[model samples]
Target chain A: MPAPIEFYFDFSSPYGYLAAQEVEGVGRRQGREVVWKPFLLGAVFKTTGSAPLLDIPMKGDYAKRDMDRSARRIGVPFQLPTPFPFSAVAPARAFYWLADQNTMAAKDLAMALFHAAFGQGHDISAPDAVAKTAAMHGHDPAAVRAAHDDPAVKQRLKDEVQAAQDKGVFGSPFLLVDGEPFWGHDRLGDAEAWAKTGGW
Target chain B: MPAPIEFYFDFSSPYGYLAAQEVEGVGRRQGREVVWKPFLLGAVFKTTGSAPLLDIPMKGDYAKRDMDRSARRIGVPFQLPTPFPFSAVAPARAFYWLADQNTMAAKDLAMALFHAAFGQGHDISAPDAVAKTAAMHGHDPAAVRAAHDDPAVKQRLKDEVQAAQDKGVFGSPFLLVDGEPFWGHDRLGDAEAWAKTGGW
Candidate 1:
């Protein structure tokens, strides 16, 4: 077994959803435990001076093609639920809401929300859509909505986003094991190998 | 048959050399011409607020791995050049010197410089080394060196670097076939295809 692996995810990114689907299985194969850390990507972009993929003319197409190649190579289901970038504010807040109730429930909610937003083309930013998604995963819809609006819950999500920035995280599906940050889904194999060797 | 493709290159980049060796072959098969454009990468970085691969921790390693993979896939002979990130001043100036004489000489000089830097691990920044490499490729060493230091040649090289910035180039090995800029060696194939189809 290896040190704990922390996965930081943003519901708005298709790559984050893809990473969520296979991270657990890969970690299990390498005898590593995993935890989910859902954070706001907007905060990350503001702090890092990062540009959206669509803004970088050639990079977006290349990245999509590369991701498809990677998904096929890894034998995973890959789909872009929406053609446009979905606002992730509500979805991100819902994650923190789940965390306050139970850790395991929070993990499940994060995966469910990712599937809804990036796997099924839903507008995850809508409070109603987010509440509905949480309900599908067995949480009370009203309770989840109320929890999402809590000032403390929203601030906790903000804090996690700030933490990701401080840790030098610049992109989605950032995985950290034993304090070493691995950015991008392509680094997943390296992350697994590092985890296996128990390298910090 | 297709229109000539502009091959933007910088001697300091290993990938540019790798692409140079094969781009002509690709052009030959499609009955197209390759226009060699040697510009300073440092100038591009300054205009775009970008850094070299070595400056981006995880990305640098990814570049090395990708280059190795690309070499095997393309059957190109590749070795990590010594004294990497060489000063591009001399080489860029040397290339402009050759270009002033004739286009063919510019093409040959570009290949020779790439091979000298990445293939033979030579210090391309040194005047003597560049002269020797040019001589080995049948160009007159003394003439090439003299042309390199000419005030007009120096100014021309500086102007081309500035022009590349004006054209929105921010990275090395940028291919602008038919007025469209393809920013990486990986996009060489696309540039070639675009040339073949007369697509900008």
Candidate 2:
């Protein structure tokens, strides 16, 4: 079988939330399976020496406008979550914990977390919030909450983030086809084309 | 007449070079004239606290690859100029000088400079090099060279950069359709759509 498309994202990223809604369809069209990997953008930012998009001067204002415009263009319900860019550790750890059991359920839990954070403007930074979202997806709430602090789960997230940095991922909504990297939500079309044609 | 699309770019930016090749076609399709405003990204970067793409760490390496890949994907011949991120002052000044006389000729000259700098990978930082390129378009080489050092020409570029910052332009290939702002080369299509449909 051909290699799967690695879909890397951060739970706090608005563009990542937007791309998640469509990446499955992109993979489906090309008969490829998408492996969802939620990593910490904050850690990547430290290596890149970059700040959050909304922290820049003029670019920040434009980004705020673009996020809303991009969401509307894609027909996704979006509102900048209050306490913008909350820590994504809770959701990310939960994703890896469940992913160890069932990849499909992990994806469902990821979408649930993304929807609650961006789609409904809920904060998924807290362990309880993340656990509640996972519980809705048939996960045990107590187990899910405990997973956030589990040593193995935390190590998994740290290793995944390091691997992402090693692979040169510097932004949210990054995708990889085979070993080729495509960054940003806008590049999803290009990524799909690359997968379909095996690079142009 | 409807407001024309404002196309802003920097000569040193690879993505700006790529977008310069296609922005005019987008404007033509929507029955709108494109106004090319070449400005100093270096000056704008100061306010935004951003650096050149290839100067950043891991992102720099990925950008080098993406520049080549994006160029090939769009069928445009591209090479990161020998001295990547060269000063754009000379060519920008020459542009404003010519634009003051004939907007059409100025547009042609802008493309010619872009082609020489990015398409052919020539160093365009010096006034003499800019003059040589301008001469190919029937401009007097000495007059074009002198224009680069003229105080009024220098002020025009400075004012343009200031105006761009005021309008929240923090990156190359930034487009304004009516009043809606779109950044990056990938957004050219979205800008065209907005112009055609008066926005979605």
Candidate 3:
């Protein structure tokens, strides 16, 4: 057994969705409790001087292809949602609210939202969609929504994103095991291995 | 048919080797030529402030895994070279010199070197090994050796690396099709598509 693994994410990122789906089983197998830390990706990127694919067309187009290839390789179904680069504020706040209830539940709903946004091509910003996805994971959608609007919860999400920046994390789906940051979904294996061997 | 593609490369990168192995076939199918440009990775990194792995340890380790997984998914034979990062200066310079004799020859030898370095785990810097590999591609071993040591040829390679940086290439295995730069081996398909549409 090892210390818990915390995953930082934004509901808008497809890679974060993949991590949410894939890293759960990996964490359980390696005796680590996978904690979801949903945060604002836009804030982190702004401060870190990073931009989405829309800013760099060459890298962005390639990323979409790589994500398609990666999902297929990993055996996950994928469908890119329209209205890409969707606003993540509402969904991100909902995630923080749910995480305060049960960390694992927050993770499951996050994946469902990802599947909706990037996999099913649904808009997660729509309150109905976010509520429906949360309900699927056994949470009272209205209660989750209420908590989402709480000033403290909203600030908590903002603080987590800020904390991520302090920890040298500049991207979504960052996994920190015993405080060592792993910045991509692809690195989940390393996160697991480190948990298993207690390696850095 | 589309115009020829300008393929930029750094021999130290495993992906460049992978692309070199397959780009010609892609070019031939589309009735386009590949203009191979061998450049120094060190120079590109120096100008762009791009460090390997973006300062995330877990992400860096997982990247190696993802690369291996990508290689396997592509059905390319690969063996991790010992002394993980080998000296690439000699082979990169040789590639530049060989371009003077035959661009196609340079491309072929570069693939062979990649297969040798990453596929077979051979030391690409060794004179005997380089000569042996060059001979397999029908290049005169003695001439290859002589070209490697030519002072003028070495200077030309530095110039090419600088030129690549000036062109906003901050990464290895950059592909320019229809004047659009596709960075990274992961973007090969996009480059191929552009070649098909006479884009680059």
Candidate 4:
């Protein structure tokens, strides 16, 4: 009805995983639509000159602990994915491909993929893994797999990431409320307040 | 009493300014002593291979917006100071100097400096500014000025920053609650909960 809250996240970001589990509720509470827009942090990082939070020196170790503790604090399941900071091309492309046909199903598949990667600490970096996760949401595995390699699906994902970078979406769990960009899972509350109060 | 909650911050950090306003209240609410430790972010950044949050590319523009928005969302005054990311040596050294004489006075003065920097959007890089802030907190201006360059006071601040790095603190508004390191003002709520529940 009003402006939809555009949630931008990367598949490999633990903070994005944590926010994915909660942003919908926040949107529902504020009477706004939550649009899940997954983009490649790898591409965004190239523009920002930053790396994965876990790739830094001492901060890398602290991030591991924070991810676990933050998940627990928020009452969500989280296990750090292995070979993390994975590329979002597979899952993101699959999401857009499915979203073209079914937006609801696309969201469901996104939950499944996030859950697989962060909930159980499994690797969803492969197209097969993303397709498998999609199947659980009633999508055909074969179609899902095909979307990953389809040129249009690939471009859709590319265009989305390009749009995000052009708009300065530099980190995971970023939200855009009426074109106001809120970065990091940390700002979820602030985003919620912005949605609720109309402005601050 | 158990261990006091350790607050590590750099004087020039916007998030640190926000946290400085609330950490004491959180500590009081949780029935713990809140220890204020000001360190040089420049030194910590050198060790962590990180630069100021605003120095990065796309993220830099977003950070400026986030700082102001977050400060309002949380109901605190904030404005980006001129020539932002100022050196913390003068303010931090003055803090440590006053701390050596009076811990309470040091905290009061710390608040004054933070208010001067963020609340009024003033430059606090000069020794005179810090001395003036301390004087407002009931300390003598001349004494505060002399402490900024005192060999012992300078070394004290340096040693504190070194110790913080050894303990893996790499950001401002970082709180170590019962040895659990929480980075960012965004994690302040998590830190408070950790202090209250003995950690989740």
Candidate 5:
């Protein structure tokens, strides 16, 4: 069997949330596994000189509508958070912490967090909210809270961001199917096709 | 009948070249007329704090491949110009000049210019190159050259850019179907659906 596809995202990104709903299904249909990897988009942005989608002037309003339209088209529930572009550090750290122990559980936690932020329109930048989501997902809230602050977990998130940049991932919802980089939810279709056909 | 979809683009953009090849067909399939309007993207960039896509650090390389991949997917011919991001002033000026006299001939001229730049990979940044492409399309090269020197034509392009920015166009291949803005060549699908359903 071929290697699993790498799905990279930042928890703060709505497009990433949208992609989270689809990448796994696309990979499964192709008989390949999708490894979810969350990274710091801010770190990539520092090098790329790009700001958050909502921070850009005129494009912000259009992006807002596009995200909504795209979610509706894709049949996923979505609602923008009151304070968007929130910090993904809590979720990123938690994901890596859990991933080291149970990768599947970590993925469930990531999905729950995304649903909380985009589906429920909750503020997830705080560790407490992340812990709450973990509890809802059948994980211990206290353990998650502690893990969110663990130095090793914190360092794991940092190292992953550096590794992602080294791997040429400059945007959220980035994916590497057989090592070909596909950025954004828009390119998810391209990545799926590449995985199916093994590139053009 | 609904109003024609306004398609805005800049001459130097590869994505715009891709859109130019597909947008008219998409509009026609939906029984909607497409009005091609060439604008100076640099003007929009100034206000939105965006530089050229190729000027961004890591995204430049990715964008180059993305353009090629997108063109291939759309079955449109594409070749990066020899010193890309060349001055599109000549073509933009000529387009406005001819648009005043004959809209259909102006569109043909735009398509020919796009073909010269991306399809044939020619350096179409100069008045002479623009004239050459115009002459190839059965337009008078001498007359186009004179049109290039016309102040009214130059101002017409500038005014159009200003008007496009006012309509929240931050990038090339921007489209408005029934006054809803959709940006990028990636959005042609959404625009088609919007036109067909009169928007969801």
Candidate 6:
């Protein structure tokens, strides 16, 4: 079997949310498992010395419009969460904690959290909101909330962020197919092509 | 006739070169004229407080790889010119000077210059080189070289750059169809769709 497609994202990223909605279809079509790895974009931004897209001059306004247009084009419901670019600590921690038990369940929880954050404009940055979203996916709300403060879960997220940096993933919705990195939600097609053809 | 598609680009941007090769076709397919506007990205970068893609930390490395992969995928020969991200003042000035007389011929010169700078790895940043490339397309070498220093032509480029910034153009290969902005070469399809459907 081919290597799994490593899908790296941050919970606060709109593009990441959009890609999460579509990446699995690409994975299923190509006979590859999509490993959903959620990390902290705030942490990644700090290490890269980059600011959030909505904070940059000129480009920020354009990004807002582009994100809306992109989501619309893909037939996905999207709205920028209030107090956006919030610390994704709660959601990231919940993902790793759930991932330790059931990978698929963790992916489902990630999607639920993403939908709550971007689709419904809920602030998943809050532990309560993240736990509520996880609860909707059949996970224990109290346990998921507790996972946010678990020492091992927090370190797991930190290590994953470090691993992403070590692998040179500096952007959300970053995909790795056999260690070939493709960044941006726009490059999903190229990533799938690379996965299918094993590079041109 | 519908409003023409405005193709904004910088000479030194690799994606701009790739987009230049493809944007005209998009315009043709959509039955719209593509007005190629060569502006100084350096000026745009100043206002946007952005750095060259090849000068950024991790993004720089990924950009190099993505550029090659994107070029290969599109079947275009591409090589990063020596001293890339060089001053495109000469080329931008020459384009405006020629554009005043013949827009089509100016576009031809722009494409030739793009080919020289990216396809052949020649430094079209130099006035002499720009003149030589223009001369091959039936322009007078001396006239083309003189236009680079022409005060009116220089001012024209400056005005164009300012206009682009005013329109919120903060990146290379930005396409505007009926005033809707689409940045990046990957968005050529989006731009074309918008032009065809008058937006969704």
| CAPRI docking class of candidate 5 | medium
A100, model 1: CA deviation in Å? 16
- For model 1 the TM-score comes to 0.63
Q: List the residue pairs that clash in candidate 4.
A: none
Q: What total of clashing residue pairs does each candidate reach?
A: 0, 0, 4, 0, 0, 0
Give lDDT tens digits, candidate 3, residues A75-192: 7887778777888877888877877777667667777788778778888887666887888878788877777678997798778777776775667788888876666766676677
The alpha-carbon lDDT assigned to residue A192 of candidate 2 equals: 96
Q: Can you give the DockQ of every candidate in the order shown?
A: 0.09, 0.83, 0.09, 0.84, 0.72, 0.76
- Per residue, candidate 1 scores C-alpha lDDT tens digits across B1-200 of 55577777777887887788788876886687877777888765654455676556545664675566556556766777767788878877888787777878777777777777777677888877888888888888898788767899889988887887677666677777667666667566656666676652
* Residue ranges of candidate 2 with Cα displaced over 4 Å: none
Q: State which candidate, 1 or 2, has the greater lDDT.
A: 2
The whole-model lDDT of each prediction reads 0.73, 0.90, 0.74, 0.87, 0.90, 0.90
lDDT of 3 by residue, B1-200 (tens): 56788888777777777777677877888887888887777765554444554233434555675567557656888776876666688888778788888876777788888888988888887666777899998888998788777889888988887787777665677887767677766667757766776542
10 residues in a row with least lDDT, candidate 1 chain B: B42-51
DockQ of 3: 0.09
What is the CAPRI rating of model 2's predicted complex? high
* Candidate with more favorable, higher TM-score: 3 or 5: 5
Q: Can you write out model 2's per-residue Cα lDDT over A1-200, one digit (the tens) per residue?
A: 67899999999999999999999999999999999999999888888899999999988899888989989999988888889979999999999999999999999999999999889999899999998988887889999988888999999999999998888888999999999999999889889999999997
User: Native contacts recovered, in order, as a fraction for each?
Assistant: 0.00, 0.81, 0.00, 0.97, 0.65, 0.65
Q: Against the true structure, whose DockQ is highest?
A: 4
TM-score of each: 0.63, 0.98, 0.61, 0.96, 0.97, 0.98
lDDT score of residue B24 within candidate 1: 88
In model 3 chain B, where is the ten-residue run with the lowest total lDDT? B53-62
